[model samples]
Target chain A: MSRSLEPLLTSRYGIEESWKLANAERAGAYEVARQALTTRKPEELREEVKKANIRGRGGAGFPAGVKWGFLNRQDGEQIYLVINADESEPGTFKDRSIMDLDPHRLVEGAIISCFAIDAHVAYIYVRGELAFSVARLEQAIADARQAGYLGERPFGIDHAIEVYVHSGAGAYICGEETALLNSLEGRRGEPRLKPPFPAVKGAFGMPTIVNNVETIASVPDIVQMGGDAWSALGQLPGDGGVRIYGVSGHVKNPGLFEAPVGITMRELIDDYAGGMLGDRPLKAVIPGGSSTPVLDPRRKVDAPNEDHPLHKWHGQSEIDVPMGVDTYRALGTMLGTCCAIVMDDTVNMVEACRNLMRFYKHESCGQCTPCREGTGWLVDVLDNLCNGRGKPDDVDLLVNISNNMMGNTICAFADGTAMPMLGMVQKFREEFMDAAIHGLPDGVRHDDSVRSMVEGVA
Target chain B: MAFALTPEREQQVDDILTRYPERRAALLPVLWLCQRQNGWISPEVVEYVAERLELSTAIVKGVVTFYTMFFDEPVGENVVWVCRTLSCDLRGGKAIQDHLEKKLGCTAGHTSPDGKFTLLKAECLAACGQAPMVQINDYYYENLNVAQLDRIIDAHAAQGGEDAAAEFSTCATFGAPHGSRGGSVTSAPPPPSREAVRLASQPPPANDEKGEGS
Candidate 1:
């Protein structure tokens, strides 16, 4: 099927100074917000969103409409809408591009989302590392407010609407919805225990809805093109709309491409990314962000029989699998952030795992024991293996620790930390074992040079 | 020296305080202002922030130490962060680090003897499309090779170096349409000159004060 759909979220990207409010409005920016506020009731907009089936673009693929439906909306209680712009997930840069290039789109989407949920206030929690994105977003909000699209009685509506840009200090844990809440409340960026989810009790003890930048940015387009039409644009049934797939590392054209939901990985790398850099042989691909399990393009499934889900790809490599949430789940990985990190044959997998593990170790919020300790343990073991001091049992030990770390934390941070390690060590067990028995290949730097620079600042 | 926000910065802090419903919620932005006014977040600045927001020093210090961006101790005049993640690593990120260390007369985590530049490693600045990039203060210098690195370092080493480096736009151009294949490097202006490398390596006169805030 031809999955090349017209760009919705990224249409304003290439335009000169698209971040400016004047340029954005000329390209039809806040017309949805204006129309939604004037013509449609909040309930109608919410129902339409529910019908559209837009999933969160931030790692977790939860339905955005379902998430909004969980809001308590108790009388006399304040409701909040937080935009999770903390795009710290390694190999993910799509959200940054949106906030940087088309801030007005996000501003308009936030307005529409708030209007639907009856939330008068919204906060865009952006990562501090993205200073430029923050500046652009802040400017957009200012211009939006000045243009009478924000503040009390926005767009001639009777309700009050306010939007603020909040900057997060460097902490990957803050990307978690609850952790983001805690960070916004001026606490340590640590995840809180569940049962009282954000929809029930969120920021500052209010009913809050946290949506990803891309998820919220998709709202304007969804509202303009009716829910069913937007739903029809996807290659898969429920996976609606086009997703911005970021192709980085060892690609001829390492950039972001807005393609349909069910486009194949081979198409992304070949047609969009212009194939591998220097025509090198593809070794493996992190089909999502670094948190998701790595996928070896050459590995064929060894399913027991035809009844198994893996049977369909029993003898085929995962390179051609259609990219979607359900498809990746069946393949034992996730379509996380849809940002693929491609590795060529010349790259060392062990060192690469160590590099990613180090990031998880440094970013672990100490609230959960497994993530705080297990991430460190994983990094140390991987470091030993990479530096030739590994024991024979280290490979199995890595899997054991990864198994223990899974499903043992307040949030999925530990699981995220463990999944990639398990994926790398288990998928490439022979390579790790070879390195354990006989050190890393010559010319490989053994020094602890990969130590996080954030450590030095701390 | 005692920590205090300048009159203008104090006004900005007041404005920031109005954005959040609670006073403590403004702590992060307030801390950012204090860090910008002064070079890094010292104990005095932490105390000042706590007093300003009615938060305890313990809470303020806990926050300062938790984030990687807030420097507790003094950093160099210019903080250069080179991303060493897997994506950048596959595209010669290590060589960039090695070249930086040699050129700066310092290791990845240390500052130069003259306090001109501090070289540090970063995870990912979300500019992987232009791999092997570095962030000098608030601006990102991407698609860097040895020659490009030299030009950038030399430009920053000279007096009012940031002005000379102003040609490098902070805004990313990677958002261009997919068909155009607009890598960030394509948008970057050509190199200035190789003249400042010697000045950068020699470390002109020592200036204890940090570079101006972003």
Candidate 2:
């Protein structure tokens, strides 16, 4: 397949050579920038992005045009665009790759987005812990300013747009757009209530549009290519042109790939990721990022009669059950950040849950009471299960705690924290229960591995 | 208690503050500059930032503590921030942590005995494809394992070799260097991509050799 028109591999592209505005201009990158700046009206710019059907690539494949449309136009308040580059989701690192390789693409996209929303300032909220990324973005911002692409009245536009790169203090909650704004404003990173969604009240209590790095990065291309042509690129109903899904664990070619949304897990694993490593059997797949529920390989009963150009659609009946934004949502999980984590038979379900619990516990911002305390409790519970100290009641306790933690916190950080525990209990309740049952189920000794651990050492 | 900004430092602060419409808006960048000057964010220096930004001491204090990058406690002469995210975890970041603790006799989040180094476990350094990575000051060292980590520490120890022998100095208030200027801290160099795989895939000392026998 031709590499042209694909998601640019950030690693392959040199920072100063292929990524910056000057490099893009030299390589015909700003052909669209020039047009968008000089010719296209702001409203037309919005319409074109809408037509391109570029869905947010930071997960929850919301249509970029529609999200931008949500902005409540105020007469005097300045609109802002915040790029969420907090790529802290356990399996999601595609944004990090893009930012590191070609931060300029994001800058260019943010500029176009700012122009569309009538915004004057944009902030890229990177994870505070990522020193290298923050530095890369800092250098890119400096370069953009020098090239007259950013800073006051850039590109001769009457409106002034100053791009700021703010590093978060490592809160997964900050990944939630509103919480990110809170942190940027120098407050504890906590999610704000909706109704004042970022479009209404965001960074510095102004109208803001928080888009994923990949979403804004796609804007330059959409502006270059006609919106309809870009929209046509996504064959699925709400499918977008290209996505950088980071695949990890047990995959042969484990790395980041740019594929259309309709691509199935099987194809991504087989064709793109070069199938399972060492020819091992695939046991489960976390289709989206770490937060999405794990799907059993056996239960992947592909809906009969599904058809989509990009997907492995067999017939028409299965179209409603496709794997992109429309389908993943219908299946009760979002294609959040497209971090496909593969697990083989060798992966113990109890152990996986324990590992995920550890991540959620470590990353929790300790803002809301449920999330702050609930994450650690979940991990402790799972840790007990993994270490074979689990009781039958512990399973219910996990579900109860996770259930309480959902949607009750300041941020969706609570939800990302809760999803894995609920998912493990839902999918592998039997495995957990079997591990929990000790020496004997009915007065007969069972010499199981879990039993030995629970019975105390020999 | 205030760390007075030298005339030149004041000018730099003024330049940055002017860029933002509101003085409070420049809190993050100004604090970053402050940390660079002091090597760590002390309460007194934070109070100084509070006064310079015209923000309440509480506000500056809140901002400084909220962000993880700014260390409240004093660190070693060099800061090595290790990424403990999934990508790094998959490629043996835990092993690197083990090696670091062994080499420096300090666990993650602890400063070395001689105060020559401090190991901090950060979330994501954003270089995932390289897997297991660390950031020394500002540079990213990717595709790391135990040996790569040791080599990095050794190199730093060698460069700041003399400083390692110094006693722990509990720094109090910020001291203005002569000329009303802050210390010029050099940014770390970026890692060469060619060395990623070899550096990341290096096996540990005993276990790797034992596996070779099998």
Candidate 3:
């Protein structure tokens, strides 16, 4: 793997009182935004971002420039830019850190992005649970507006710009772009059917562009350094720039680290996160957020050619696979959010699957039948398997439910839930069979007595 | 009794309304304001919000029920949310939830017998790096073990409402000082006393010409 790059996204993380506009400005916050607004045309800025190859960090990994291209900028139609700051994916916390610590960077990015897309108004839909981040972001917007960087004719440009902070009342599905638009409009936080995608008719029946917090936060840097120069920061050809990889669960120093896109899982766990907690042997890792498929180091590559990026680990463990969008996709998983949750050897695979299933079931928006019902059924079987009540065919039943849920929903939520469900069961089939036939191992059974005390909490 | 916003709060509602293009789009903020003034969203408040936003009661109620943060029923002075997602769970979040239940003498999703706290199991709070954390009111108590949690609950129990809500500090190592002008933290104002809310729910005397206040 290449040497770690200098921090771009996280540069302001450790600065004292970085959330303050003055401190952020002193650290060179809005210089690029000012320059871009004064000197660059909207299309010029958009093309630069396209050349930089910055993907959406919220989870989808879609290129920001491509998403911008889809916008129907009809004359006299109000254009809206919505920032997805909902950061609710189970193991992802990078967006929260950015919003909490260096909110001005996000504000600057939003200012430039809105200008680039010809949007005069932007609403940042933050998860209601993150009260602190919401406050910080709101403050930053107010400060930027006061400093003549956000309101009408900001920075003396002819175009007007406005940014507002809107909070979600704790709905995970709102993280989905369309659902976020609905929630912003004070409607039920349910996913809307797509073809009139947010690009064309969004946010009160106007042209809208929704971009993730991290993706927008990269704009100032891309503008400052020039697109191709910024793109060269990544190890891979297509995947450009650094990612704030967040590591949690059984690591000594579990926190966010800024590294190039193709950094390996071993590098993240060992070099960045200080390795496993107490130096325990690695068991498995959810390479991204909870929705991503779990990767077991013990599993070997099915087929590896010399030309493949993962060829060296063919006979050995696949633990050292590079963490990138294409590489993970090549390995039958995704680099969703790039927030890894590491598991040590002491953890139980069955219980872990149950933990994640319960989350997906609780978060399913109920808009689609397959996701609403399939998630619940998966949880029930996992619960049964964990509590020594599993039927012999429950293993097959779990797989069957997961297979049916995939690609069968209005949104990708059902598919995300099924990815991990199927990943764990297939990777650890024997464990599921063992739990089903003989119940969870000695200390792994569900504590129903305690559970009853907290029932209906969801 | 019919719910009515004070003149000042009505002005605040009007300001929030201007931010959105449509009046009904301000429903969430208006609902939040109602919840802040009262302990929870009573039926009367629902009707008042619907009227204020020019939305139907059914539309307002659907929104309230859909989102998790809005409370339809009265809760204790403090609401404690224990995150039970995978990252925290792997780091002993479940044990902390169990401990809180035992200590508070109530199950999750219910207020304690003393009416001091309402314990709820939260989804991933996006603070996994500091695993095993709980959000008390609007402040987050992170990197918690049983002992740390005990001290926090005890302090809140002793201090009571607003003071206690402001007393606990965040474990965030960087950024502007929380609650500072630059950061400007906005927690749900300390809930009104249960007795006051109950009294407010009752109808006024039949002889009164003007109901409560204009």
How many clashes show up per model? 0, 8, 0
Evaluated at residue B136, the lDDT of candidate 2 is 71
Comparing 1 with 2 on TM-score, the higher-scoring candidate is: 1
Candidate 1 docking: what grade?
incorrect
Rank by lDDT, highest first: 3, 1, 2
List the candidates' TM-scores in order: 0.91, 0.83, 0.91
Over A1-458, each residue of candidate 2 has an lDDT whose tens digit, in order, gives 11124443232343233445565567555456556876789999999888888888877677889988988867788888889988777777677655655677778788888888888888888876565567678888888888787777678777677887876665676788877777777666767778678888877778889988888888887788677766665547656565666676555555666655565677667666666755778877777677887767555434444453324433322212346776676555567877777766655666566666777887787768899899899878776766568799988999999999998986677787678678778878887787676512332112111111101001
lDDT of 1 by residue, B75-172 (tens): 89888998888777766677789889999999988999989998899887777766657888877766565666787788788844456346553445
Worst 10 residues of 2 chain A by lDDT: A449-458
Residue-by-residue lDDT tens digits, candidate 1, A1-458: 33433467777775677788998899999999999999999998898788778878998989888988899867789999999999988888788888878899999999999999999999999998788788889999999999999999999888899999999988989999999999998888989999799999999899999999999999998888887777667777677877888877776667677777877788778777767766778888999899989989877766559787557667777877778887788788899899999887766788888989988988898887888889899888988898789988999889999999999999999999888888888788888998898878765567543321111111
Against the true structure, what is model 1's DockQ? 0.21
Better by DockQ, candidate 2 or 1: 1
| Candidate 2 steric clashes | 8
Which pairs of residues have clashing backbones in candidate 2?
A: A59-A336, A59-A337, A305-A315, A305-A316, A305-A317, A305-A318, A306-A315, A306-A318
What DockQ number belongs to candidate 3?
0.18
Task: Tell me the whole-model lDDT of each prediction, alpha carbons only.
Answer: 0.79, 0.65, 0.80
Per residue, candidate 3 scores C-alpha lDDT tens digits across A106-222 of 999999999999988889999987777888888899899999998888999888998888888888999988888889999998888888998999999999989999999999999
